[model samples]
Target: MAQCVTAFKSMLQARLLEEKLASLYRAGGRIVGGVYIGKGQEAFSAGLAVHLEKGKDVYGPLIRDQAGRLAFGEPLLDTFRTYLGVITGPMRGRDGNVHRGRPREGMPAMISHLGSLLSVVNGMLFARRLQGRLGDSVGATSLGEGGTSTGAFHEALNQAAIEKLPVIIAIANNQFSYSTPNSRQFACGDLLDRARGYGVQGYAVDGTDLTACVSVFSEAVKRARAGGGPQLVVGSLLRLSGHGEHDDSSYIPDQVKSSPLGQDCLPYAESQLKASDLITDEEVRKWKDEFLMEIDAALAQASKEPTPDPFRENWRALSTAGLVEGQFEA
Candidate 1:
């Protein structure tokens, strides 16, 4: 294994953990006020995204919230621009929210179906093969553990196994998928364990454990890169908060919320490093203050910026394209 820098990784992890704390302040003002801040689950998204970017990988997000997207590579302004209906918003503010990630140039536009993106994964692989780019291309899809019970999951695994397409399907099993407890959705205690039956490697990790998450995803990415076919990782991330904007996550607890995995990314990474004497507590506090100040400045800047004109030139350009008449559609 290559000697990867741990200090920056720790800092990066800390920056991510800052979500739980900061989101609390902005949740009420956010689109779906009180967004599901996956406190302890930050590492899963980070690790998975880091791995996928090893190649020109495509992220097929399925309503798994925007944390993963932001961590994966979506710009900060693009994220906030989403609320303002700005063209800079991913997809020009069209398509669904949550999985509303920008396309990687030639990648397919994101679909809103729950687990249906699996078919797109297969199709993408097929198209790449036709173009003699199969080995050079790869697909990555993400879904909640809840979506695993759906038929799409089986179809994806079976097809990928039979065809030997390169893909990395990450299941962010954030304990509870919305209001429904995971137990109600499946009989399997661990979803990753099912990967072996489909003729691919499967593994589970403590999604909160950033180091472990990084190592696991790194290995999976290496395998996929070497054309070992697709792999499945069931990230057992603790949902320290509620399922979404509506329900109270009384099923979990505030105590669970205290840990790095349960609260958010930045602090977890900070605390972990601090515990291991990787960085000083003062340095952690400085980093937190710096990030918060940056956020405050960004929000303040956003407050002063002019709202985009609904009838701006791009809007007019769209109107002239017979978009309302559906000229672009097949």
Candidate 2:
């Protein structure tokens, strides 16, 4: 019950923050890059992240994973800083807003290529195993169903299976890959089939159901940590908004939008929490108010911070002087 409440709170906070980001982007001069929000997918994203142990477990969140990032211990201020291009953000304002991460803290800075994050997490877990520091620590990464079609996803899953690494590959089957539908992406009957083909344990859940997401993800994490090799969890839902703030998502049909999977998870999650006696309407309202204030303060502070000054910045690929040229080859 406590875990559910916490996850719900993270989802709520993420929704609020993303809404603010979208507004800022619409205002025409705030954000540096695209604004991507995990609208209908927050429950699934937060569910997996809430089970991860910060500093012990690793997570690589995708572009639409603000909820997961927060549940995995990312600061709310950092989101604003990154989007506003404040130099003090995790990316030091050098990268896109969605690409911010702290590698030393187990979250790798994201690359825009689809399916690439799985390999990155696999490498991190493999490195830890080689160092004899793995010790039941699991690494997890999230991607869309479309990413599953990439070669990187196949190679990483195969590597993890061969190595028996403890990892979770979360797939948000949101029905469409941007404007493209699933029918065009793969011929498999279900995504779980891909897991079976890879010889990894697989689970399916309703992405719109917060309780179901939490339950399934908890079990998946447990299995992975217990030496069950990689776990693939595919959650079915719909992307409630456009791919980014720029696109209007007119490509999505009305019948599809009205489907049960298309329903927004946020309200459903709140209702579940209330009915379970874990939270009340008053409490939910209070949380929203508090989150709004925090977001306002974060944005205000980040807006006043200076962006990176190119004149004072080091543009070299290697920042350390000792690593230069042939001096270190010996």
Candidate 3:
């Protein structure tokens, strides 16, 4: 019950923060890159994140994983700093806002190619195993239905299966990939079918059902940590928003919008908590108020902070520390 409440709170915080980010983006001249919110997928994202150990497990989040990032221990201020181009962010404001992460803390900085993240997490877990330090630790990464079609996804999952690595891959089948619906993405009948082909354990859950997400993700993490090899969770839901703030999402059909999958997870989560006697409407309101104030303060602080100056910044990559300027040219 406590875990569910905490995860729900993180989802609520992410939703509120993303909402503010959308408003900031719409106002113009405030944000740097695209504004993508998880919207209806928050429950599924947060569910996986809340179960992982921050310092031990590797988490590779995609563009729409604000909820997971928060639940995985990313500071609220970091999100604002990254989006607002504050030089103190994880990326030092040198990368896109959505590409921010703290690698040393087990979360790799995301690249534009979401499918590649699976291999990134696999490499990290494989490295820990090689060092004889992979004691019950697992690595998890997320993707959309579209990402599953990429070759990187297939190769990485195969690698994990072959090596019997503890890894969890969460796929949010949010009905559409960008403006493309699932019909155009793949013809597997169900995304879980891919899990069988990969020889990994698979779980399917309703992305809008907070309780189901919490239950499913918990089991997935547990199985992975217990040396069950890779686990795949395919969540069914709708994006509920545009691919970015620039899009109005007119592509989504009205029938799809009215479907059960289109239900907003945030309010549904609140209702779940209330029914379980874990939280009340008044408490939910208080949480929203508190989170909004915190978000406002963080944004204000980040807005006033300095941005990166190209001339004064070190252009060298962190991994090239031991090499001289001309050493790699040979």
Candidate 4:
């Protein structure tokens, strides 16, 4: 009961923060890039990641994954610092967006290329096994439904299954790949079917139902950790916001956009919490209010930090210093 409450609170905080960031981006705040939000998909991230070992099991999160990052122990201030490009933040004023991550916290930095993540995560899992560190350890990575069609995704999943690597591949089947709906993406009966075809354990869940998401994801994670080989969990949700703050999601059908399932994850989670007698309406309200206030303060403090100047910091990123100085040319 206590763990459920804590997980719900973390998911709530991440959802509120994503909404706040969207508001700031629309108001012309100093967000250096697109603000991708995980508004309706918080449960999959928080639930799947909260139980993993902090520094042992690495998980790569996509742009729309604030909840995953927070669940893995990222500081709220660090997230704001990353988005706002604070000079002292994790990325050190480099890429100012969800594309950044802090691996020291068990969260691997995600590349923007969606289909490519599975391959990288597979390699990481293999490396862990080689180092004899695979005792109940698992690595995870995610991609949108559209990503399943990519050749790299196929290669990664097949290889992972063949090697019997401990990895969890989450498919956030949010109905659309940006503006493109599932109909255009593939003709597979479902993503789980595709996963099964890859010769790995596969399951699908209602992404909006917080309890269900957590249960299925937890099962998949446990299976992977037990050397049961790779498992794929596909979560069904909607993209409540635009692909970015700039692109309005008017492309989504009105029927889907207005459905109860299309609503944000908060109400669904609240209903479950209430049904389980885990929380009260008053407590839910308090959590939202407190989280908003906390984010506001964090953002205000982060905004006061100096903006990163590339001239000063870009030099630090140059890995081939000796080669650049012509010392290695000969």
| lDDT by residue (tens digit), candidate 2, 1-330 | 687888999999999999999999999888878898888899999999999999999999997799999899999988988888778888877886888899999999889899988888999999999999999999999999999999999999988888888999899999889999999999999999988998999999999999999999999999999999999999999999999999899999999999998989999999998999999989999999999999999999989999999997766568675687654655
The C-alpha local distance difference test score for the whole of candidate 2 amounts to 0.91
The order of the candidates by lDDT, greatest first, is: 2, 3, 4, 1
lDDT of 2 at 253: 93
Model 3 regions lying over 4 Å from their true place: 318-330
Q: What TM-score does structure 4 among the candidates reach?
A: 0.93
Please, what is the TM-score per model? Answer: 0.77, 0.97, 0.96, 0.93
In terms of TM-score, which candidate is stronger, 1 or 2? 2
Question: Which window of 10 residues has the lowest lDDT sum in candidate 3?
Answer: 321-330
lDDT of each: 0.61, 0.91, 0.91, 0.82
Range of the 10 consecutive residues with the lowest summed lDDT in candidate 4: 321-330
Q: What is the TM-score ranking, best to worst?
A: 2, 3, 4, 1
List the candidate 4 regions with Cα displacement exceeding 4 Å.
314-320, 326-330
lDDT of 4 by residue, 1-330 (tens): 455566688889997898888888888847877888887888877777776767788888887778877777778998889889888788877677886777655567877776787777788778878988767888887788888888988998999999998888878888989889899999978788877897999988888777887788788988898889999988888878788888888899989977765866767778888998999989988988999999999999998999877667546335776655534555
Who wins the lDDT comparison?
2
* lDDT-superior candidate, 2 or 3: 2
Residues 126-149 of candidate 1 have per-residue lDDT tens digits of 687888876655677777887787
